[model samples]
Target: MMENIIRLNFTKGKKTILQGQLNWSNRSADSIVGISGISGSGKTSLLRVLAGLEPEVKHHFRFNNICYSDYQAADKNIGVVFQHAHLFPHINVIENLKLALKAAHHKAKRGQANQVTSHKFELEQVIDGLAISDLLDKSVEQLSGGQKQRVAIARALLCQPCLLFLDEALSAIDKENRLEILTWLKTVNREHQLPMFFISHDSFDLQALADEIISVNDGKLISIQPIELSALSMGGGLNRAILNVQFDHHIQEHHINAYRLIEADSLKPNNGVLIYAKGVKAQSAITRILVACDQVAISTEANFNSSMINHIECKIVSILPLDETNQSVEMSIKGSASQMLYAQLSNYSIQRLDLAIGSRVWALFKLSASIAI
Candidate 1:
């Protein structure tokens, strides 16, 4: 029954918000874990319990070989970013940051220096990374919702936590800033080997960041699985395909970092497709990918002059109407090993390209859409 790599028997509440065991054995140290659930489903409650805020609930818990008592969990130097920014109203932004640094330093001075397992993050680096330099002089009360979130994020990173927990922390920020911070988070996680548990209601955040996602319902863990776009409950979301993917690690080419999409492990070696993505790393052993079907463009021949990276050779299998007016159609194509993928194109472009059911063509997608998750 305890087959999971880290078994969890948590009783977060008396009536039990989470009265179940977590079966997560495939998790890696550097993997970003996502917690997803509805608004009142105890997402934050679970996080609070794990961070030692709800120590009473954790008394009955024993996780794998390690059992964190209230003191250990509370004093483990875990960093957390809450949904609502919890900045001190009496202090300015810089003062708030200084207070956090001071606390971390005091924790270190308490003869617990060995607890700092992750990389030591510098204050200036975190400020610049989160783009919070301008707001340092302003009081916490004067900042907007997004600005406060940025500073809160900065404060958490400055602590140099071994484990980080984000409880819908990015929900208040705009899309652009959220993406920027998420990218930085991934970079820091890889460089310093920081394991993170990010909680968000947005599937896009989970898809872009989480190596594996844990689903929750009625405050109970429903499942823990790898990133699958279909498993994300993206109904009426972007059209995509899950294909058996094999890629070589990221390498530099003409001053650009990219990954080479190789054929399946069973296939012989050949010149592979090159894709540029921010999330690609050589250490990642990803074998499958979720391809945005809308981003896929079909062509009779490979066109490198255009910026599109993927040029997969496949045979057209079938075409199905997308709408009542038939302005567009969803086309299916088979690559090596009979792997099927989809592309949504307009009727005009299909005729313009002279694509046929059995004709061979190259599927083209941009460098940005090559997210392995």
Candidate 2:
């Protein structure tokens, strides 16, 4: 069992968000703790303070009964995964992972050849676990959103930190790959007893991944509660709905009959619903049902035999390049009801299909690919 106590305060401009004490303990439970709140609610600030990235007005942290000042605590094997991957654009995937290990070795007082070889072996294991062995030679500029996130996670793991802080680290990943990475993380946490602070806005993710949930609002600790699996039935008048709840340590099953409104435009208000469904059963509903723009496919014509369940007729509103490499572009489209959707397609595909602003296309995706919050 590990014990941690945190007392910190931060002030910006004329407003002070954190005022008093915030404590946490994992005496008899899992190490991962979930922090959730809306934007500007001090979630990221809390992580920054803990990571020693932000100077605290006053702070004290105790890990495993060892007392240390804020700056001193930052030196303790602490690992962090920010929202953005932030990989070096000039380096390859393997080089990025090895950079941290090499730095740590150079800083050590004793660096033996055997120790260096052992670190290299550990790096191999980490890359293999992440399923990125094939991506070792690929430059960061060539990687997609999901791939970059995976490399970032692998790099963090290689640091071998006792405490880890993840701020929406899995936000950019696709549903399938995200689950796979999460499973690997669970194993690592259990075997190594590594404590982690996870921050996300998804309620279902908190319920599924966290043993204890820490709620924060306006920079104040709101509540701390144990996660319990229970069936919640939401009833309505116009639409008939059925929610089949299944809860275990590993998986959460949710079935809901609800209407999904796709936003078409950011600058203008939408007056009508784009697509309405009578029933929807997402394989895993632990995360918010948001499909990444890159996961969606756009075509000039719809295919009836395709496995994708959701297909909306939309008109391309704009096309924006995503990176300097010109490998991918974000295409924004508007549905009949003024709801907007985005799809990431290759520049080659865009040119091949003759897709441009005002072009009619169909946005296609499978129900399984949608992320549930």
Candidate 3:
């Protein structure tokens, strides 16, 4: 059954920095919703209004069919994770997690005396699910920047709110850690089917985790677009624009052209395999690589002395089917250490290879072959 998603319609007092009429609504209950705007665009202010942290200032917001600002039934179920870890320096991870659970129980109107035992068990379960079992007893000071953030996220999730709001949550993290945390966030969302509302100016954040992007400028939302998080990570900009990689199947070439280059960071080690050209013309020679997945061929081993200069030894890590016709495949090459290359192939090839987990294969790239999308 479809669930009730929050509808947030609010406006903050006009700040000289960002002055515009603000009214937007989110209809998705189980999807990741993102609000992106430039610095001082009132993104954080809008988030606070929705979260009910700030006193309602002549606005409307409803969650689970309940009015958040209404004098009656003003309380609403919500969880928030900010950019900083925000954990108490004296408290350990488990205690922090317990605090969230306690808050949730209180919000649910459960008696404090009851459910104490069950709450402990639930807290342990959340900690384990977030992969922080090793950090359960550790104080906040002992945790790394990434680990603390994970704890904070875990704390938020433990609240079991219908809506989770993240405010530029990964802004302080390093690039590598940010990616890892994003991947974990997706997994958590998928596993639990919890909806998220994220606020950020970083396109990479939107690309990595957001399913739908809502752009805001001068405190006003301009447009909303669908964005696949995986597409952002597959050779897309880590901090800049998230570019999706494409390979063309119709064209075939033995020799590679100058524009046929892989992502710069991807070429660093074992991190990238998807080839992409930045800031180039549409008719560029590398454009041939933009073919549909059905046209390309997959091989267990590279064809010796073959004309295909794009042959690279790869390890198949995942096979994600895009509907009935196409598949998005994840592969790791020999040299890249922290990155994975993604390729779009056909379901026919997946069945043909009887591909299973941990399969080794060679992704044949006819220098001219390309993916259309």
Candidate 4:
């Protein structure tokens, strides 16, 4: 079980939207937790309460394993982003980012003064990673819907908070922009290890990003489900098969050991593939990765002595970052059409290379270093 950053045990308002049964325990501190529920289900209200943005509501809240409130006030680090862009139309992009950092800085403890300065450095790095360096002076009114959202994301991250709340922040964007933002969000969550609370109504949106799907209706939380594959098997076999993957952890090589017998008719087809391996572990040679546009770092000059084993020369297509905290530098490699790889790097690196959206570089990684399947 995971320890949650916060929990709720009290009711809100006259409607009795949340009856006494809602509870989430064992939540990791730096997790990208998402909430999916229908409209008028109080998702926004829940976010407000957790963030301490709304104090009138009755509830119990905790921060970093310490109880904050059972209707009592407790100071906690929190950053929030609403559906709208919330950018000041008169302010420029970088100026907006600085404002967000200043606000978060005020929340820092008196003894932790150095943390505020360090956080400022991080904010600059985050802004650079966002790839809006050239647009720093561009006013908010000059930005498009997508661009505004990107700035908003950077502002949220610049806060350097322990917990973040996103209340359908992507709802106003177009489809292409929405997809692009989702990829960036995934990258940020993995790279920075920031825990978040994402509220949305779309199932497809949740499927592409959520570690656990929690459904809410009329203010009540339904059961949460995690996606998993049960087994892998072949067609027309009377007995079901279980793939036993064996690998050398030290050498980083993998092989199939054998298969176990089980009942047939348990398999189902999905999108063209029929078999699923849920809990089975593969040999060390194979790697499983949750893709992040930021993690795929590329360099124009390839080096032989570096630890990177997976190196591929690619043409730069587009480099995007939701905000300064998590940047996505996209590249188009040869022979792999429409396929791209990302390298997660700090804002400093993004500026050090003076990388443009279309510059050529070599994407590098250690094949053995990624998460093993």
**Candidate whose TM-score is highest:** 1
The parts of candidate 3 lying over 4 Å away from their true place are 1-28, 63-74, 110-121, 228-373
Question: Model 4 RMSD to the real structure?
Answer: 17.8
lDDT of 1 by residue, 1-373 (tens): 2233322345534566664556565345677778877877777877777777766663333322233342455466778999898998999999889888887787777773435558888888888888888998999888989899888988887776777889988988898778767767777887888878889887767667776777777767677676643342543445556544345555545333354443443544233444455443533443335576677878888676666756666777777666643332333344344345578777777788887788788888754423443
TM-score against native, each model: 0.73, 0.57, 0.55, 0.55
lDDT of 3: 0.57
For each candidate, how many residue pairs have backbone atoms clashing (under 3 Å)?
A: 1, 11, 28, 18
lDDT, candidate 3, 1-373, per-residue tens: 3333333445434543222333334344456877776777667876676676766444565543445555322244566888787998878888888888777767668532222111122566666655789998999999987788778888877776666789877776777667556656655665565777898666656655676666666766555555533343323233122223333222224232233223324532213344432222333221212322332356876675765445656788877776689777776655554334556666787888777568887766542212211
Estimate candidate 1's RMSD in Å: 5.9
> Sorted on lDDT, highest at the top, how do the candidates line up?
1, 2, 3, 4
Candidate 1 deviant stretches above 4 angstroms = 1-15, 59-73, 111-114, 228-236, 239-258, 262-271, 276-291, 297-309, 314-361, 367-373
Evaluate residue 42 in candidate 4 and report its C-alpha lDDT on the 0 to 100 scale.
66
Candidate 4 wrongly placed segments (more than 4 Å) = 5-13, 17-21, 25-29, 63-74, 111-121, 227-373
User: What's model 4's lDDT at 321?
Assistant: 62
Superposed Cα deviation of residue 81, candidate 1 (Å): 0.5
lDDT of 4 by residue, 208-244 (tens): 5555545556766655443111101111111111111
Residue-level lDDT for 86 in candidate 2: 95
